[model samples]
Target: MKKGLKTLLIIIAVILVITLPIISSYNNLVSLEQKVDQSASNIDTNLQRRSDLIPNLVNTVKGYAAHEEEIFTDIAEARSKLAGATNVSEQADADSELSNALSRLLVVVEKYPDLKANENFIALSDELAGTENRIAIARQDYNKIATEYNTKRRKFPTTIIASIFNFEEKPLYKADQGATEVPKVDFAD
Candidate 1:
């Protein structure tokens, strides 16, 4: 009877030895998933910061270029879309629209030397640019973390574990349309 009890104890120990690595992998995957989520949240925070800066920017521009009401309206609409977005994909789309609108607004600003020279507009533009940089960094970090988590979860034995645990794949942050296009600058013109 003592020998039988000893054999049972040994079997339990062997099972633990076999399962420990799998347990460790599961924990690591969870950690990576959380990191990805946190990074995505950081991106949203930065985007929100940029959105908050938009009104002042729009107002300052309005003060100078009051005739350019349509551009200001477009910016306001895009900013609202961004603020109302509930998910990452929606946020990405809205952000792209807002960025395009801002680019158009900048073009409008270029037409007015007085607006460009305004101290308030300059400060707001500087703040918006800095916020955009932060948003880019945050997006990159999120994509990196998501990629690592995805790769690890999809590899070999972890794939089985991920399937059993129902780990979902994350979507990547996509760049805006026309972002890859090279500018046509003709100094001769």
Candidate 2:
């Protein structure tokens, strides 16, 4: 009986020694993935807030610059694309397009000093700016957490576990090409 008990105890210990690290790694990966998902949701929330504010901004600008039909159309189209975007890459591209369209609209506003000075426009602009800042911070947080998760998942024993569990890599958010360029505003127009 003593010898049989000893054998059973050894088997249990061996199983624990092998399984504990795998369990720990999987739990850690799950926690990090949840953080990444929450951060992505934060970005979407901020983007939605900005989208909600655009119509008010557009209407205020429209009141002053009725003839700027082309810019308004562009803004509307860009807004539609942004609203329909399904993933991070599509969101980035649509965001860049909306930003460029807004820049052109700003130039139009510049032509009408009164629009810039309007209280409604000023308030909406401030809200939009704050939301944009939130969006940037959210994107940064998402990338940081996602990078950490990816790194951990790709490491030694964890990599084996991650592969078995199908922990696919999360994509890092990248800015659209030419997003850094200062949109040229033709004052001549």
Candidate 3:
């Protein structure tokens, strides 16, 4: 009986020793996933901030360039798409669309000297430019966190734990295929 009890105790200890690392690894993966999520959220917040700024800018430009209906319509449509985007990749694409539309709108504004010199319009443009910078920084930070999470989750025993937890990879915020080309709103003429 004593020998049997000792064997049982040894078996329990071995099981715990083998399982503890797995449990710890699983917890670490969860933490990394949460970090990536938080980073993504931060980027979304900046995107929303920029989107919110668009209305005022659009309204100001509308007064100066009432005939530019197409640009306004495109901006509104892009904004709607951005608002309804369901995933990170969709949101990024919509964001780029909105940026292009807004760029076009700005180019149209350049046709009017008064609008270009308006203090309110200039302030809004500065704010929009600053928000764009913020979005870029947020995206960079999110990508870094996501890369770390993905790498950790795909390696060794952590991969098994990640699979068990269903922690899938995140989509990178990549530029569109034509991103290297000039934006459609070029007014170099």
lDDT of 1 at 43: 93
lDDT of 3 by residue, 94-130 (tens): 9989988987897898899999999999999999999
Q: Give me the overall lDDT of model 2.
A: 0.89
**Model 1 regions lying over 4 Å from their true place:** 184-189
The CA lDDT at 91 in model 2 is 88
Model 2 off-target regions past 4 Å? 180-189
TM-score of 3: 0.92
Looking at model 1, residue 54 earns an lDDT score of 92
Q: Each prediction's Cα RMSD?
A: 2.2, 1.7, 2.0
- Every model's TM-score: 0.92, 0.93, 0.92
lDDT of 2 at 77: 94
Residue 180, candidate 2: how far off, in angstroms?
A: 4.7
Clashing pairs in model 1, backbone N/Cα/C closer than 3 A = none
- Give residue 94's error in model 3 in angstroms: 0.7
Q: How far is candidate 2 from the true structure (C-alpha RMSD, Å)?
A: 1.7
Local error of candidate 3 at 25, Å?
1.4
- Assess each prediction's global lDDT (C-alpha) against the native: 0.90, 0.89, 0.90
